[model samples]
Target: MKRREFFKKGTTAAVAAGVIPLVTASCVGAKDMVYDRKQDKWFDLGTGKTGSNSRKKTVAYDVAVIGGGAAGICAAVAAARNGSKTVLIQDRPVLGGNASSEMRVHLNGVNNIKGKAERETGIIEEILLHNRFENEQESFPVWDHVLYDFVVREPNLTLMLNTQAIEAVMDGDKIKSALCWQATTEILFTINAPVYIDCSGDGLLAATSGAEYRTGREGKAEFNEKFAPDEPDGWQMGATLLMSSKDMGKPMKYSPPSYAIKYTHEGGHKRRKFAGFHEGIWWIEVGSDDDIIADFEENRHKLMGYLHGVWDYIKNSGKFPEAENLALDWVGSLPGRRESRRFIGDYIVSEKDMTEHKHFDDAVAFGGWSLDEHNPGGIENISEPPSYFHYHFEEVYQFPFRSLYSKNVSNLMFAGRNVSQTHIALSSSRIMGTCALMGQAVGTAAAICNKKNVLPREVGQKYIKNLQEQMLRDDAFIPKRPANDPNDLARKASLIFGSTTSSGDAKKLINGFSRDIDGKNNHWQSDGLSADLQLEWESSISLSYVELKCDTNLQRNIMMRKDSRNDELYFNGIPNELLKSLSLEARVNGKWIKLGVIEENRTRLIKFKFDTIKTTAVRIKMTETYGAENVKLFEVRCYA
Candidate 1:
């Protein structure tokens, strides 16, 4: 008999007899099939290979995070750091999903607000700082590795790479266990976790587990999102495989594959000069809305052809006279998918929430980008009113904590681009910075749930508040105002300084601290002097330190600084080292002179004592030891 016929007959008989036959070079061997007692059935056909009817050991965990993308890493780290025995399962070898080194897409967000990095913090900030240290300019691969290391290094996190979750064990509506197949070992491993997080952008876990989800655009009436189409549309933002090129001496010959030319520029729709070329770094996106999974193979081939075609066009064509030396530098191994399955969460954030700047009671993350819906054809579609437009709000809009948890599955949480949101809302929130913040928030929430021994929904408003506070404390921006406290006040002061400080003294201060001050629209200079000499400190020791004094006891809060940008204090074009040596002192004219010295290592601030200093002027003078030629005060004010 032929090999195919023999194997087919043998497999059919063995399966019918409740056994699996292993084929070997010499002979075929059969083993009895063991049913999963928990699943109450025999293994289903077409499941991934897991060896010959042998059961594998199972490990129990507190939390299981599916997918190792930006959100998954954050969730695993958060769960592990909070004392949960967590396991992170990723099908790919590398951690970053879309933003991986393989993909090589630039991390984009609202980072260019007023020319300053805005609302970017937490793990994302750590990664950027790491990038800054490793390379003067950032690289995506380095960033991807940083995320991978962060997950694998966590003591409580068990990172299982090259493992795909093929089956889920469900009890009623809850997930009891998940079965993953390891391609290398050909073994099926099971992991039991109390809580599960779907960080997979494709919503694979949710889909396989029978969790409710949505796809494509929703009708405007459903959520009242103005940008949403009047009628429900099947349109979704497309996917792309990006490529890069550098200048080479001569032009290279290139041709696209037959499948790549499926759709061409037609109906007088002119193609851009670099449309088919890959010479330019920025001009590297291609794919289609027809079915991401079905067309993925063909799309990849087309991308390669287009990339080479781009290089050829640049070098051979006369468009770029200076690009005689350009050549293909890099191309992505995997395509970056923009839209997929969106898991249904407790609350779906809508575009109306963004337009109205809707404040949620449980706001845990904020996003500021406008709705930037891409065209169905993978190329940016330009319309009359334009498919993308900015909202009326200048401030970032808040996303609630409830939206991060699933509504159908009690113990499941989600993050990243797959979080509960309409397509319009996702256009703004899908940015990496916002996704990182969402990851940080979800991680914090997962930790809380694990520690408290409660369902995600039962985690409560108080716990959400605590999580938000912790996120803000870690530098992740939430929509709510941070609590007003001495530490917060000091941090604000340090931010105002924009330079490193030691102890209580603002020592080693650089000149023109004013230039470093951020968030200041107007250019303001400092006038270093006491309004009245009588109000100054009595001793030269007190004069050694520079202090911010306030008058009229204003009811508003005051943020004083030597300069707007950094903590550099200068006197007569000379760097003043005295600001670090002396402590801050405060007094309300002869009434037990509160006389508190500036803390040894931090910015100096004396909250106005309204009871005694009402209608009085407060003075901040240096200690007597430091004498400066001319001391300038950057900013002085009192707030109620």
Candidate 2:
């Protein structure tokens, strides 16, 4: 059957899942793969509505994402939106990984670079912006639901919470199916897919599939890391237990739980200042010098004791009067872990790769978080700073595709903290925000892998440019790698100009960097709203889609913080620079006809889809902004 007919005649065939050979699953990740086409076809096979039926479940998707953290969410969302039938599996009831309410480690990214922020753009940015609108209160619990809503809203995505992808059913070097355990439903699910992404920080599936991975600290000579221990050791960064205290508006009595380990702070490091005591203490952590994941429970208990111990010091200790009224409001039982298994990829991203800013032709993502290697012994070693702020980046560094997939496992790709990198390199890339971008990259690549019927490594070796082009069109910024999508009709225009040139020329819109960086502007700014931008072609061209990348001040952070900080560096509210009201019209022959209008725009990458039109010129009129007096735009693209 023709592939188009495979989608059209969906109701005719039974979904005889694991054995059907998956005819149409070869499609690259595109949003139109599977859907309501067979919604009315499922026959009611249940006998007594709640009878003892088979607990084994079988489903299929083009891409299967293991883990529902920031990285996993972005990966699943990207694959689904790009047209792949995608599944996101999370072992926990809630999403957000370390940033989840249960853990609440802040989702930090390229927060600062030499006194300015060059924030990430793409799915991760969309997520943060969504949080700003839906979670202005910055409540961590509400943020979880906000993320759940975001994932469920995607028409092509399926989410399974409290489900863990425990094992990989391997076929030679590729993973044929994932044996997942849905804890809540008590069902063992067999998820079949062409591509599998292990964004799970621990990479359980990758490990079980025999993907090459390494744990523990690397010697400085291995990756030429300057900050590495003299020789390789089993020491891994610890998991942290966090707690929040709220001021009761009056003095409250203090008492220590029996499990509390006494904290005297007699020999504490000088840098361990309780700067934001009311929110939580980050250094209240514990690490394992050996078998970190194996020591989770032991570390959890110790971390809990240490948490209350520190709280006892703040509340009962006479050193500070301000914390006398502060009482514990929330405490995390699950520790947010750092450093477990570093899956080996074709290339291992080392410390110098980031600090030296090495460029990769197969670069798919960028990260600028500092080399924040936490101290070896955690809070137990109070004499040391919680982390050694090894080095900072003045500019963002490229993350290569070769370092995102397994060197041994053919079909397995990874994102999040588990992707192939040295311990020192992970210090910067492990930040949830940075991990989110990597998720989007791999997610998009997974769709491409399905479309091309190739492994992740092939996607890197041959089709890397295609992957980069797609990411760019979707609003991901690859520093120095300007987008050159061949299908972008705006680039072919004979003339392009804005109604008013204020900061950058309209011609710069096709130059391809989506955000201003390194003191160079890649966007066009209007003197005021209601400005007009036009593109003209020498002859009539056929087109149906128009995409625009607008300004959201990437130089400032929009991530939700514990303090809900809204300063110049960290912004808690929606960006005022977004173009709120815009209309698109195309010139047919000599007259102009309206195409579409967006009144309540929410995304930085604005898109318009309509019937194809033969036009010699197109005009976009911007009427208003969220708040800014002037409207700014980065790029404009059109496709048929």
Candidate 3:
């Protein structure tokens, strides 16, 4: 019998006998079938190939973070470090969604905003500083391990790689557990948690949990955005398959595959650009006019053909002599998506909120990138430019806590490209650096919720100050606002200086400005190498933790780059102005007692913890800096 007829007969016979057989090409020869008791079904996934015996597993945590990209990484680390048991679930073998080795897109943030260098701080800055300390070469694969190290090193975080969150176990409006399928181990994971964060760029977990969301471009009349189209349409930014090339120092041969596309100068020369060979090409994109989520596989296949076609043209076309020795080094298999389903929140961010700088009382995060909109035609249109610049912001815009949580679902919250915003607003807020800040905000809020035993909405309404105070204590910056913790014991005490400051007053340390920005002069700088700043009170008080905000040079860049190096920013060693050695002390019974000392400090925020004691005075002693002669600090606080 013919192949088609034989498979059809086999399928019919299996259905009649109440036994479903693997007849399709995807399930042709799989003999291993495991029955899931919880799901009450059978799965024929190819997990035996990885050589693992377990087929099912269960776990619990205080918080669960889905999608191990920039937002998810920050969320998991922030939640874990803030004293919450957190679990991170990732679908890919490695971390970093778009900036990973699998998809080598540059992690852009407010750096590209106008011409000023405004880098994001907090957990994102910590990750970049780690990369600068370890991966100096800026290798993509090495960057993957750098992200891995950041997640695994956290003591309270549990990372589960190669696990895709397939289903959401919901109880009424809350997510009871996240059911994930581990492809390599062939095991199903049911992770239960009180709070859930959906940092997945595509909003996969939100969609499965019945969270209301919006997709496609909004009409001009909807949000009154000038850049929006006249009518609404199901069009989104295209997915890109970034490709990189390297010179072999010798000639390399090339041949086109059967599935590769055929292109000429008339088809792609005028529209597409191929100037840099070392970095991945971002123009070879697809899937703007089609459904990005429902038709993901088809879109990815089409992008692969287009990518190979571009490479073929560069090598075989013989148009440029620079391509003689250059060969394709890496081509991404996974397409880095730009836009998809966005959860609907209480407030939908509009273009006016970004351009006019609207005030949000519960602002947790901010963004400053330009409104960059890509053409819907994608690669199919060669008549227009690949992108259209809509508008730029005079200053950074604030993101509200109302826009970060679900309006319908009680326990759901999201970050990254899928936040609550219109299409025009998303064009600016979609950058990875801005997304990282949102992750930090939501994660900090999640920790507060777990501690107080309240939902996300309650945190926004009643305990907003608690969330803001925690973020500032952890070194996160809130635009136009200063950290003033009323519960802090240092706020009620008097501050004294051991020595005079040169540039600014020593009283600036208690003014609550942690970062130095334009028109803001609140930092205290000492005159000489070693100086002391002491906090004294009339009566003795019990203290356990001391938080210090130092200067790490926020005006310069510290991230790893692929192109030419900027020695001023991306140096081989640590920043020159960072404090390297410091010590904390307290005076009890007329004698100074050393509490803690740090010989090597690499971060902007430093915390000293010791046994609780009643002391009348606390002192911070500094000895040496990385390079600067004078010691500079932003804020100092004591908590009991």
Q: TM-score, each model? A: 0.66, 0.92, 0.89
List, residue by residue over 1-640, the lDDT tens digit for candidate 2: 4323322333222111111121122232322213112233434466433324355689999999999999999999989988899999999999999999999998999999989898889998898889888987889999999999999999999999998887677799889998787778767788999999999998877876777777778998898889999898877899988888888999998798999999999889998889998888889888877667667888999998998888888888888898878888988899999888788999999999998899899998999999999999999899999999999888999999998999988999999999889888989999998899899999999999989989899999899999999999988888789999888999999999999978988989999888888888788999976899999999899999999999999888998889888888988899999789999999998999999999988899999999999999999999999899999999999998
lDDT by residue for model 3 (1-640), tens: 3322322443232222222222111233433354322433434476534343556678999999988999999999989998999999999999999889888777777764445566788899888878877887888899999999999999999999998776677799899987787788877678899999999887666776777776779999998999999998768888888777789999888787787877664755364577774466676667554346656788788888877887788888888678889888877889999998788888889888999899888988888888988778676664556677688776788888898899888988899999899988999999998899999999998998899999999999999988888887788777877788887787777666657588877777777778776567878898887888898999999999998878777766776666835654444446778888999999998899999999988788888999999999999999888899988898888889
Whichever of 1 and 2 has more lDDT, that candidate is 2
C-alpha local distance difference test of each model: 0.56, 0.87, 0.80
Q: Candidate 3 — which residues are off by over 4 angstroms?
A: 1-34, 37-54, 112-114, 265-272, 498-500, 567-573
Least accurate stretch of 10 residues (summed lDDT) in model 3? 17-26
Clash count per candidate: 50, 6, 0
Per-residue alpha-carbon lDDT of candidate 1 for residues 170-237, written as tens digits (9 for 90 to 100): 78878888777656665567889888888878765665566666667899899987778898765666
lDDT winner among the candidates?
Answer: 2
Model 3 clash pairs are: none
| Ten-residue stretch with the least lDDT total in model 1 | 552-561
